[model samples]
Target chain A: MKHAFLDEYSGLQSPMHRLDPRAKLVGLVALVVICVSTPPDLYAAFAAYLGLELILVLISRLPWKHVLGRMLIVLPFILVVAVFLPFFNKGGGSYNLGPFTVSAHGLLVLWNVAIKSTVSVLAVILLSSTTPFPELLKGLEKLRVPRLLTTIMSFMYRYIFVLSDELQRMRRARDSRGWSGKWLWQAKVIGHMIAALFLRSYERGERVYAAMLARGYDGGLRTIYLYDFGAVELGFVALVTLFPLAARLLAVG
Target chain B: MHIPDGFLNSGVSIATGVVAAGAVGYGLYKAREELDEKSVPMLALCAAFVFAAQMLNFPVAGGTSGHFLGGILAAVLLGPWLGSLVIALVLLVQCLGFADGGLTALGANVFNMAVIGTILSYYFFYGIKALLPKSRTAFLAATGAVAWLSVMLASGAAAVELAVSGTTPLSVTLPAMLGVHAIIGVGEAVITVLVVGTVLAVRPDLVKTYGYQPPVPRFEEAEVNQ
Candidate 1:
């Protein structure tokens, strides 16, 4: 039951992996905001953003295949917008592509969604892949995110694999019982499975709580500090922030 | 209804972000005072349950499959405050961990799926259940209807966000989004009813909103069992 799909590459040794999670979180999120906010027509700015991302990827030493594969997650959303491209062609100038008459405005909209979503998704992937999930949660806690929420999230991350493995076993059992999920009535079986899963998870939760109490757990979860935001982290934050801002401004100017 | 980034303009993103932040912050604050020691672990496990349950994809019409949207289901099982918090945590994890949703659009996604999908739908469920008779049938029926409505509401909210972002006019995104979700909502309703009904039968006490009491065995039946 080894499901580390969320941050598979996080343990790899690299410059990106060494930075404080808080710095990476803030810097990468800022990059995403700036990248998404830039006008669709600013091709140069978009290129700069893309270039910055490429440089970071290279520096991080993440495999191109991993990054490219993750980029595919955004394709469904991009395709949804792309499908309506023709209908969006209103007053904006129209372009004839054989049988289809798509508007320039519609094309712009597609580009906007496609590029921005791709870039934003890439940033998130880089952040997640470079930083282990626990460290990232710690970063969030230090960065003023609510302690309660972070604690819950950490727990969720911890048990997600266990529950999902449980789900997989259930699915296998169902399939073995000739439950092809073809007929509409088969939904009842799935429902029962979900309910059973909930019950099992709830019981497990109770047991975990009991175990925690036995170990002198006093409601609040505590961990020793491992991250320090010193010169390197600050410089990384500044470089990420100012470079994107400069690209955006230069493009606007 | 996980909206990716760039689908919404910064204005819509920021506005929804503020609203989502405010609501989730309040939820966190309330949970501290409201949830007891055991509930902390319970809530976390429930969130994990949701993430896992959503992966259980069931078949729909026309050779297609649809997955469960467990917002109303969660709210029904665990009151609105914890329910919405669970959905929010799932969305956040999906956004960062899987890159399933965009970083910039996390706020909008949380607003749509967590806020509108869970909290608003729970109130709707309460109203609908009140109107219906207090039988298991009525309860399951109400769950189905509200589950459908929750999906519709969430998709409608997303369409509005897109329109407000000026990504596409409401004329286009609205009909399109609602049209697709209308089908998806049926799947949502069916699964929600079945899941809720199953839980109600096995462990009615676990259902916070349902409050269904299992029938007590008669003396004759108990004697026979013995």
Candidate 2:
């Protein structure tokens, strides 16, 4: 019913939160590229990137716990990738742990992936925590993101919850009918359920199109609210644009 | 499965970004006629379903869990172009509002999950449906198979991107990604089939491609001989 999992923290206010969505979008992109492009061995650069991100996280006023918790979502995925690096990455320098050998090079690769991914993820969290979904869509559209795709995205964002509710209703109906889905043959029952869902969604699409036509929706879309690039937005963009260039220049120097 | 920013090299990410932008542009041009007023709300609802479905993570093997990608599911119900747009929106929202994905990596994520996953699966599913009976059952089976394959294919493409960027070697990443995702694909297939079937049963008119005539109907009796 209440899906606050997305945009949960977007209502909060801070300097970062006050910036334009497009500004945040561009800034975050610059930060990610800067952090990611640093070589694996550049521990100093990595530390700097982490510090920069930490500052932004604090500036955004999103709770540290929340950011860390969200970052953990990617941990399992990172582990899945990093776990095998010790075994497969053959470079040199082995350290004798208790039961097995840990390669020095493998550890560095792990650090490279783990840290970069975490920082990149944190940057994203900061951006999302500050920006609302509708404005974000509007930002993309204004950024020259194709309208077709944006329109599609806008609808999906709007209806994903509705579909979820539909699914729950279907599941409930089945359960009430004593459909436990415990046995292998019960799999067929699930199959039938799937078929039924498809049919419903299909029919809904046609009706939805008909409704659109009734509203005089022609092929072209004209938006009522035009996004203006304000001074604050410009300043935010300039600040973000400088960070990556500064980071790269510092690295080279 | 959306790879965030800094996951891949700038060259690769930018290249994929350009590709993603072009595909979306082409998709917009193609779907211009279909994106009229009536389709807007339905498209929105479909996007919401995908977003919700993604939140519910079903368990996979080895104590690992996977969520539905919903590309094929969206395509099967909304047609490929609209489906891809829906998924792209979901990803965009996740990045900007939910912070589920990276900002710079938005292009690559759209390419992997939205474009490749939806278009490829829809075409393949559509192709399969052409060979089978025009009944709902045939559509269900074909949708299931294509949905499964699409997930696997997206994973394969991701693995390639990682490998190309030298993030991880192909030998190590390929089998690990494929093996895990192959299992994940089963969940995808099941979800796709179940959702498609349910929609078909309740409101058959919602499916954009429903009642679409195949090159030749497989079963004579199944045909509505007016």
Candidate 3:
């Protein structure tokens, strides 16, 4: 029932955390766009990008272990998609590694996928780790995102843990009833559990609606609107912008 | 599966971004009719339930386990627009809050899993449901099979996006993605069927498939014309 998978280090105080969430959002988007647009063969630009990300990570005061650990979630997919690229690509001038021929261009493709994904993911990790989810949503709302989308996310953030706790209780109850069998046989029970959850959620929805109405709740969701923006945030955004630009120019030259 | 940033080229990413934005925009316009003051909470809660449900993992065969993608289940329960909207919200949170998907590649992730996955599964489930008898068993079976197919197609869509971006060759990426997803599809089928069957047992009315008009009988030509 206990989940800290989101914005775990948001409580930490640092320059990155203190910057306006919109700044982080916009800055990170620019960072990703820049990193993704760079050619893979430009190893120097990649290093500079990594350095830029590292500088931000260090400033953010998030644990390196946590940031690197999150990479595991994205790594396997990249490996699955790119691992064979080196072998399957029949580009001319390839080296023989084992039975399969690993092409130079193939290696470049692998490098492109791996490095670019890593850099962008790292930038994301830094951003999410530093910015709290609610502020992030507010930042998005500030940036002209659809109000409906933001409201939906607001509820998701609030009730995700509640529903997960309910799911946990249901699981415990099932386990307590000696509900142990191969899924092939016990699939029926799982199905019932899912149904029960849906029904419970539906009923809960009705109840929540009643409560909101009793309190004269309007349909719209509104959060207090103030993000502290000063010299530090602007300077931070400026540096993030400049680093990518400088790296690309150097990579091109 | 979440597509990471830079795995896709800029051109493909932008294209998918445009497509995804249009789909979500359309979904919003459509979903607004379904969402009201009372139903909005319910809808949001359903999205939360989906978020929670996605975390419940079941063993596939190995020590590894696969969680239900929830696209088809949501589509079957709450029409495709609401379903896609909920899944898109979930994907958005995972991308921003947990860094589960890429920021730049968020469009591709939503397009593949939410828009494509939910809409495609809904239509497929509808088609299969029409052919089968109007019974609970047929409904569950249709849901299971279509859920499996939906995941495979979504993965193929992602693979194609990657291929178009020149990230990987189509011949290599398409087969690889589909092959692994074929295994995942089995898990998706089992879980989707199990959940639909359970729900049908408890509250028959909650099954969205049942609320729609019955498929016209192929043998009864006169009834259809009337």
Best candidate (score: DockQ) = 1
- CAPRI-style class, candidate 1: medium
What lDDT tens digits, residue by residue, belong to model 3 across residues B90-167?
A: 888889877788888999999998878998778888999899998877888888888999999899999899888887
Q: What is the C-alpha lDDT of each candidate?
A: 0.87, 0.72, 0.82
Q: Each predicted complex: what DockQ? A: 0.67, 0.38, 0.52
Q: After superposition, how far is residue B143 of candidate 2 from its true place, in Å?
A: 2.8
RMSD for all candidates, in order, please: 3.5, 5.2, 5.6
List fnat per candidate, in order. Answer: 0.75, 0.47, 0.68
Better of 1 and 2 by DockQ: 1
Cα lDDT for residue A14, candidate 3 = 93
Off by over 4 Å in 2: A162-234, B57-66, B130-137, B202-226
TM-score of chain A of 1: 0.95
Q: Which TM-score value belongs to model 1?
A: 0.95
Candidate 2 chain B: worst-modelled 10 consecutive residues by lDDT: B56-65
- The residue-level lDDT of candidate 1 at B22 comes to 77
lDDT at A177 for candidate 2?
A: 89
Q: Which stretches of candidate 1 lie over 4 Å from their true place?
A: A2-4, B212-226
Clashes of each: 0, 50, 0
Return the candidate ranking by DockQ, descending.
1, 3, 2
